[model samples]
Target: MSVLPRTPPRVARRGRAVPVGGVLLFAVGGTAATIAVVWWVAAHTGSAWSPGGDLAVYRDAAQAVRAGGSPYQVDRDGYGFVYPPFAALVLTPLAVVGPLAGYAIWTVLSTLAVPAVVWLLVDHLTPAGDHRRPTLLAVGTLAALPLSPIAGTLLLGNVNIVLLALVLVDLLRVRGPQQGILLGVAAGIKLTPLVFVVHLLLTGRIRAGVTALASFVGTVGVGALVLPADSVTFWAGVLDSSRTRPPGEEAYGGSIRGAVLHLLPEAAHGVWLPVSVLAAAAGLAVAVWASRRHEELTAILACAVTGLLVSPVTWYAHWVWSVPVLALLVARTWRRPAHRRWPAGLLWLVFALPLPWWVGYVLGWAPLTEPAWMMPVDLLYTVTAVALLVLAAVWLRRTAPAARGCPR
Candidate 1:
């Protein structure tokens, strides 16, 4: 069976093309710039910006589980373990080492996940026979490492990259009946990835969807068997607080819901929920439309973007999905006429800049400033997400076969 549909012939019928050497040189230069910026931030911030504070939290949660305590209630440095019970169980091996050692180990693993995800995206998105695929993956991953969202994930030692790799591997690499298991495992670790289950169902991969759902249920069953009380506590709304954005986090939280709360009055925060519902509806409709056109990657990405936008508390670290989005945009633009590919170049510049969470960093900055100036800066991430969603719709329509009608 075909691993992926062939790139539309029009993509291969290119006219003027970008010079590969220039692209590589620019990528290397961008990578160096990112390193300088990260080094500057680390030096200025000192240990306040130390790596693995979040990994340390996960380590403590794992230790709690090992000691027959409730991992759900475990908190370290005021950060609670917001992941599912199975995640704690999975991390239990870390308890063998001290927190510092665990941090080092997690940092190495998470760092490696960066390039791994890059390879997965490049390998799947580009033609299998393209010689430049390795170079593309290397340049993309190097450039991505310095981006605020991806860099922040590395600095904080989060599992978002690992989760991203799992989803991409399931979609782009996996074969046979077990294809969806990794996706389910990812969703079990963090609930946000369940959006892929919806994607699979909409795309008519019923068996794979059922397999993913069962794998998720299997994780819950394992948790129940190992720690019955904690399982009950987690499944109930009690552990919901674990996933809630901390008070004062909304300013730079970057989700549409978070942006809505920041821009509106306190009472109007309730409006975010309804707005999120509408966004989810629209985003999912786009995903379904892409799926109907046999654009599997586009469908999956639409769902991923939707989940990020609709979630109440998507932090900068959770934007690892942006890496895949960048790869897709670059690929799409590579296939376009030379003059029409400016969006790809503009977007790369946008992602390369340090994300401006400074307004939030400077307390009361929003209120002190005029709405005209502050509102756009505050909603930068949300705007980027909406733009990507629009791009996905445009690409779907442009690439859809003439025989297939656009969704109404």
Candidate 2:
């Protein structure tokens, strides 16, 4: 038998060099993009904002713990400590740092999360050996960082990025005993992440769901043990009231509740609760369908959007979900020609542009005291969330003939 000629060692080495080159390119690009975005944000946002505004709640609460005071009694500028008491325990270390130092550390961490999240999304959706993956990730991070929601997250020092990391890392992991603990702790810190527990259940990740529930309860128990009176007031009273809605926050909040309350007369405000419930139910069903189809990204997006829409208050800062949505849309449309890709482009433009300006313009003409902006910019977020849920529903239904029947 004739032996096939062996490839030259030089040729094999050249093949190896290409991917190493790709890796190096990725590292340099990612680092450069992250630095540029962070610097731009810092330079533009002069020191006019409240130093550690949202973070102050945690820091102040932690300082209270240090002072042997109750965290629940803590209120910074009329915004009481809304998070579970366990979060105060977690944030106690930051209390040691001065305000400016804490703000700097928090900003840096949130800034880093922007690129890290973008990288994770691109890495997940893009296939291995695609030469464009690293470049796309770096470029996408650059593009996403300046969007209004992300900008707001950084400026306000919100915990949404940390929350996003907890959910995404848990979702990306292989099924295991330790899978949902982080998510549970995240929910314990902020109640919104509990929706992911529903996601875990819908996806048939029963063990993970249980672990998450247990972890969440563990936080509550820890809080009760550490400060029983504060725990009682928070769980019993503070959690489900207008008090949890911060002062003047309705104008900035973008939830369905906010939109409905803005759109309708004062007499109709009560209608928002039922409407929110229905929207959440429908959204979760769509997430469940996405899960059944193994569309993990779609499912996560659906659940996150649902949580944002249904939450009593979702300020622009809470919309860290938009980053993943934009990245996923980019990954889907990158290979398509420009002519066939306008839908993704349109969505990206809607997000990437300063759509917040529209909100401002509309509100200026018809102050939120008047509801006319709802016809224009006021309902923009609520509408976008509904559209995404519809898209997820359509995607799941169209992909599987057996699943065409409406989900209950």
What TM-score would every model get versus the actual structure? 0.81, 0.82
Which candidate wins on TM-score? Answer: 2
What TM value does model 2 have? 0.82
Model 2 spans > 4 angstroms off: 1-51, 246-248, 353-378, 400-408
Q: List the residue pairs that clash in candidate 1.
A: none
Per-residue alpha-carbon lDDT of model 2 for 342-408, expressed as tens digits?
Answer: 8766776665445444334333542343234333443677788899899878767776422332221
Q: Candidate 1 residues 1-408, lDDT tens each?
A: 122235455774673454667765665565555445543443344243334556767787898998989986776545677877898899898899986567666766776677788878777766566556646766877767766667777666678888998999998778779978999999888888988898888778899999999999999888889988888878886435325544444455667766877778575467877888999988999988877876667778899989999876787678888788877777666756789988767776665544444223333333333334334543777888888888778767776332342211
